[model samples]
Target: MSSTPSASLFKPLQEGDPGDVGGYRLAAVLGTGGMGKVYLSYTPGGRPIALKVIRPEFSEDPEFRRRFKQEVQAAQRVQGLYTAPVIDFDTDGAQPWLATAYVPGPSLAHAVAQHGGLPLRSVLLLTVGVAEALTVIHGAGIVHRDLKPANVLLASDGPRVIDFGIARAADTTALTGTGVSVGTPAFMAPEQASAGTVTPATDVFALGQIAAFAAIGSPAYGEGSSHAVLYRIVHEDPDLSRLPTELLPMVTRCLSREPADRPSLTEIIGLCHELSPTALHQGEDWLPQTVADSITERLRLPGPARTPQPMPTVAPTPTEVSPSTPPPGTVDPYAPTGLATPSAPGAPGPVRPRAPEPPAPGHHTATPGYPANHTPPPVTHQPSAPQVRQKSRRTGLIVAASVVGTLVVLGVIGSLLSDGGGKEENKGAGAPATSSGPTGGDGGAGAGQQRKDPKPVSYQGIDLTDGYQLMLADNPPRPVQSEDAAYDGGDLYFKVVNFLDESSIGTDNGKLVLLDNARKGSLETCRTETRYTEKIDLDQLTQGSQICVLSDAGHVAVATYRGRSSESDPGSYVTLDLQIWRNAQETDGN
Candidate 1:
């Protein structure tokens, strides 16, 4: 056995320890297990990696070796942001070892033991991270056999799950003996002890135990011998009364003994956001609504009715004004600066006002030279013919000059407008004819232009028929209305857009998205619409055609090889033609 380090210790691996195993040079012993030891190691190029070596006794068993190989295969299927990735492995070597990406952090057990349990926020953080990891693993058709505090590590970014040695492939294949547990006894669910098969729900039970420990510094089944704890887990009700009210539902759902009774990883993620501060900070609280209907539909469990509260409305009050206020007017300093009133016929005279003064809140006062209620005296005069005739001559000259300038400007404007209009009409004329042009355009004018542009006509919402969408390769074609609409099983739909300017879908990159629109109606509304993408394998892109497909709710996706390009334009077509049924029908509408 290897010497153990203190629970709180976190050290980088060094060189010349074990030299190299699975392409990683051993640096320091990170932790030891019952059947293997994990070392901090680095690649020849200086990349950090976690290298694990199987115990000599375990390695001697061919059956164990076979299982280890299968586990490696199962781990490869999982792809997620939260889980640690398996980087390399050598199960056939003298000392079978598996190397995974080295994640820096303390195990949940160590973190809790050193820091003393956790606060509500940390517990929430751990909940969402672990749940997210479980979602990905379950999606890949794998079940984590053991999910205890020791198996979860608390990293700077988030929590991560480790130890896939005991994980099982989720299928008809049975991997262990009957009536004997294959996982940790303390964290095992009741069905696990009493002929219960391994499933995603079994991991849920263990997560409940870990969450309870994080909250109250103890397991929900109480501290006792493994047999006693197993018996209680099988028979007793989980004591979640001490849990925070917001987390009670999550813990309760996880602790359910019946596999079918437990909530899914997707539902758990939604709950974690609701109850955990970390999930709220990440803005993932709306993930639960996507599967709430599915959970409700599949389980058909009746929940307590909740009373709805009325919304409050506030009215804006308008400001009041007083009478005696002058009507609103504009004062243009550039205008002629005098004011005068017409003289009344045979009775009064004109009134002349000085510069207009600003008004008080409720009153207006006349200016210094203006009379408020009387008219001013009028004057009468006549001019001689020489002045009137000169004025007429100047007016005629000004009119002629202005008309010449106006005509010149209008002529230029009309010419420009006509040119622009003709261009637009010509542009409009080309589109209809091009689209309706013979399909046999020799791949030059019509079909050739289309292949070059491939302008997406519309976003046909993800096709989920027969799961055909799931089988679509990376370069999935936009579904054509007339041709090959027939769907096989395993299709999923994804919403993709051509942000041609922002992204490289056409020239460099193709993007995939999963939308969370926020909780609405009686169910949960999506919170945000977001995209999650990873770089595609260059070899996969060049050697063959591939398309990326995501199911409508963004819960599932698959990558497939469509075919290679025959034409010069490097456009690949991804098609969703799988027929899907009941559980997979959570399209965008509902």
Candidate 2:
């Protein structure tokens, strides 16, 4: 057994200030915690170091002292350049003190506090560096069960992961019962909280939470008491709505409740690498407001340095309201759907008038609602009664022929087709040439009668619903809701849902795809699957109002078109909404 240690024999080597320990002079106090007080120390050559002196009470615990010694030894084994190098230690002294390379920089927590939030670019940088650091730390067979904002340091070189004091070595024997909680409650994964096994997945989960914090300026799980936060982490859904559109999916995958669902550190590093090379730098640019604020606040907490300045807050612009039609001379009106909208309200509404109805079935007809007898007065009052009589006779002939022709042809084609055909050639204006050609196997005749650039599809104008206008070629009737059906060029699918609701459409085992102009393929070739649930509201019977394309697996996708108009300009064109989901119904309960 290791002998109990004495606390008083550790006296200052030099009388005046014991200015130097092991040839290193103490400079200033860095911080104090349960184990010891950390001091900024320097060597004779002016190299800086952090020297930690153990507390008297902890010195009495032989087991804890042994663990601390082991910690020092384990830390020495970490070969990564991101970690501070352990230079020397004197465990036999009355009060043991250890020195490590002084990593001069701000903690991740502090940086976030000073800055309102890290931008997307900066977040990418922070993510890459931290992920690389974690990879290196784990490679050394150490589990950093206490990874959090405070444990990370932002040095001039790159982001450095530090504080391996409480880290446990893998393959070591377990001395404590399972489910015993350790480390900061906020950053701990569910498995960690239950004293479950720690693996690379745990670190990935923590990194995901960290990335989320960097992106949204708050934890995916909101602020609350320690118990509530921990419970939420273990059981609740991570609110990823605020994450940037490009990064949301990746972050969501990381926060999955199941350990297996979370990604590996290598995968996490790859994602970070994909985001940006600069992210591998020391100063992570994407610091969240909470993190920035926290860091800023901590820096102000009686530090040797003066408080840093706070970052400016910039309000985002609002999303533009979509219009019914694109102005003349444009290819299509609603082009950019599924875009991240701005938060500004009081935005000007779209002002363009609806486009002229295409000569198709369901086209709104003026004759049904307006009388033909409402004639325009001549520029000058004509005295000749014969001239008026002749005009009336011609009108009567035109009207009579149109009625007879439509009646004769009505039996040959379906009602939907006749309605569209009638509009193409009205009242003896001329005979509408009906085309005979092979359709794309879709039953409808409209499949082959489409214009080269078909008109944009409009929604039934459902107010307060997350509806959007859509645009597709009038090629064939696309499959809207079937287990395994292919989409055609003209058909548009649409649905309205909130963020969480959108995230949950089927069996908690689903994926959502928001199709917009960002997609590379033509609308007809874009094939995907989706899942559904009762609360998901995938009513397939609705007309062109809000078409829902659903699969038996509980997947869904919606399509919509939106435009903009102004007095000074024709305005812009973009697709307002398009959502697709694979079965994720189980996620709803959470």
Candidate 3:
């Protein structure tokens, strides 16, 4: 296995991101999720670690903090060959963070996406490693509530399970209140989906899903929205017909709906051993050539520098001034500009006179536009008589009317310029103005702009076959051959084989959320909805069925199924109208 460190694995810390936390200097951003960011850092002795900083909302809760401390202690005790152990942590701080031994390899999800499903032997070996890791984890009285493919790192030595006991701590937090599920939708156990008791068996169910995903390149329960997947896990049986014959019996037993019916970790390890007697002896050759090469590339990347980069500082916005407050670029004559010097220890300090009292409400002591050293003359009672007050009121009304008149003229001129400029710009760009339903191509100008509803973009006549995969993230979305280099980054794949007339659309790096009866203007619904899945079966939909696809590039696209090309051959070809909202988060008008 290559031990080279690749720099491409790390992204530079962004502005306002802390350069260092505790004593460890952050090298770069490892990744980010809803929980918080993970940074690549090194110990004082130079050993690399993945430091995960909890988000403020989670860390600020006293209940979460107390649970976090307990979990960190249990996680530190977890020591196994296939698990990344927590080495250091600080739960007492304002933002609690924990450091784990960094595993220099792509996640199982990334590896499978880059290279197709793993060979049968490789899957068997992966099962053995993960099962053993679970044995050690369960022995330490910790249940890995969430054990999806992304949490498993494929190292040269073997698979290393990460985020083991962390999920338990998060489950107790207010973020995951009562009756809410904590794990990923596709891999969640029946009990977890229904918010029932979770045990080590819950991890076993997820492990089975991971194994099936590695061998079949998609989840067994079939995916769409989180609700759909969770409903199927709780009510419907998993479609394991596509699973390899050698691994069928084991995976079936592991995915049993009832927790008690699921096989124990020891039984799972034994089952894997039966499938591949020499699984332990596969060594570095266990992974396929493509996956092995990916791991080698990741290991060869150079580690980040130890020195911390300076954090960028943003100038504070100027405060709005009221009648009593001093305006910007001007100083108050009555306010002190310098501070008194500190006196020597135990020495008598000079007696300083008290400052003047503040002006009463609705009164101004300092004159406008005055210099720092300029002091205004003392007020006289002669100017405050009733006749003088009337004159001042009339002057104020005149100034206010003049200001309003100037603003009205400026508004008219600005509106005219904006309309003319917008028309000319759109004409030069050759973009459409009126909404003519969904049409594809960056969703035009108004697609992701703030405060305006995104225009729907359509993609018609899309064909889905066995060897060709759909690339939703690409401009002018199209399909490419399974063996094509584009397939590595492709979002969805359709598989059709004999005996298993199953046809499904599955993604590796993106999510597909089903919207049952949505129309053309479903972009806003897609952007706001949170439930997402990796794949969805064609049999579950009908004509005019809408599906929202959150692309790998963070673009929200709505895929409206426009029926199949041929009724006899449903999987041969299908039509879809897409409305892609780019920069999905910006559509919220933040």
Candidate 4:
């Protein structure tokens, strides 16, 4: 193990950080170490993941990568509550990185610091959860070298074991130098600090220390420098005096100086269940009430405040005539439904005003508690009265011109017949006087209707619930092989995407899309078989809302993770409340 100090916690990537680590987009720096930097990244499906990127100098060592690869294989076999299972890794990269499922909760260390020591009941629940997690870890023949508060997460259902960056199998080539220690000194077991042979018992010791920290808000051995803490762990007894009296005995046994003297994981789990009968599980309150409230606020999705505006329209051209029983211009305010005829000029025709058309039967004004009114308003071009008259006069001129032209044509025919010595009058009379069928009194526009352009269809955002986390990729979802197509579009509109089948969605699939200007822009036309990416935008979050997104097997989700914007970096950042999605009901969504 390297000797550098642990200088950071999960933080945003600093300058010089790689945008892409091992092809995964590095989103944030999870923590920093002497040997490497842990990054927060995601798989192709938009699933957030934690990546531990080993330092360059270490990656240069072939033996190190080989051992790293071997441990990765071993850790893969471990699956349990509380443990973050390894999903992928690259042991041979220039700077190797390991990726694991990104847990959605905060670390135990953060929890204790924020909320103080957990309540007794909560401590018991944590014990059961962590012990169950440890059982799985030990069962895989791996000893978690660093089982500290920072490595335990308080998930909705239970505690999740994470950060196995220093975990090693019971029987493997020790990856570190021959006589070096390889874990946090405060939580390290006696054997680890002394560079002695370690067994599963070493993890039990660390677990005890974690429990003590969670209970008393401090390490069992108390705080000190690395050397002092290590000396205390190896030579002195754990100061469990601060732990609750009832819990002292069990904690002491787990912290036994002799590894063989410690209680087995099975026995520890039994004690935990006996102490807290209602163990944490699905659909239960695993965290304290306040913490849960904070979590809920964080994941609440604020409804967008602004609705889409209607498109601007130009007034329609005026009609010339109307089919009416009344004399010229005596028709109702509007022309008769089908026909358009010139209206009388000079405004003396006083037709009584009609009632408001009874609001089209069911159409009500925007009054609250009124019965439903589904009828829409009439589409009115509403041409001005003077403009209407001008159009009517123009229509009359066209009609007069047409009539003159027809008479001239008829006269010409009669003259031709007379010259040929035929019955000219008969020839002229026999010819039908049909005038090319201009309807009586109606101008160019008649009962024949014109179609109007259709209105736009738009979508809205929703608040997300538990069991889901989502983040819109900084890069819009587009075809993997397609040439990069980037553009600066205005405000976003969101849509939930449903994958056709479970297998259809993966790391590279299930992205949400936001179609800009739905009225003018085209909706995506990807194949029905599967879709992974869509250009989506989340800007203009309802100024005060916390937004979250979730990607389950075949469902896309979004939720509120926090209630307020970050105090330190107000508009500059928004943290997405993310969680791994699973199951068919996720398709239905909450």
The top-ranked prediction according to lDDT is 3
Report lDDT per candidate: 0.49, 0.49, 0.67, 0.51
Q: Candidate 1 has what TM-score?
A: 0.45
Question: What's the residue-level lDDT of 367 in candidate 1?
Answer: 20
TM of each candidate vs. truth: 0.45, 0.43, 0.51, 0.47
| Candidate 2: stretches off by over 4 Å | 1-23, 165-182, 277-590
Estimate the Cα RMSD of every predicted model relative to the unseen true structure: 29.7, 30.1, 25.1, 25.3
lDDT of 3 by residue, 243-317 (tens): 899999999999998887999888988888878856365388888878877766654423434222222232223
User: Tens digit of lDDT per residue, candidate 4, span 68-182?
Assistant: 6545644655667678876666554466667777776767887888888887777877887788887776654456677888788777778888755354422243445543334
Q: Choose the strongest candidate by TM-score.
A: 3
**How well does candidate 4 score on lDDT at residue 118?**
82
lDDT of 1 at 572: 27
Candidate 1 or 2, higher TM-score? Answer: 1
Rank list by lDDT? 3, 4, 1, 2
lDDT of 2 by residue, 155-266 (tens): 6556677776454421132322333333667777888777656766787788888888877877778888878988988888888888887688678888887888988777
Candidate 1, which ten residues in sequence have the lowest lDDT sum? 344-353
CA deviation > 4 Å runs, candidate 1: 1-17, 165-182, 276-279, 282-590
Which scores better on TM-score, 2 or 4? 4
* Alpha-carbon deviation at 243 in model 1, angstroms: 1.7
Kindly give the stretch of ten consecutive residues in candidate 2 with the minimal lDDT sum: 461-470
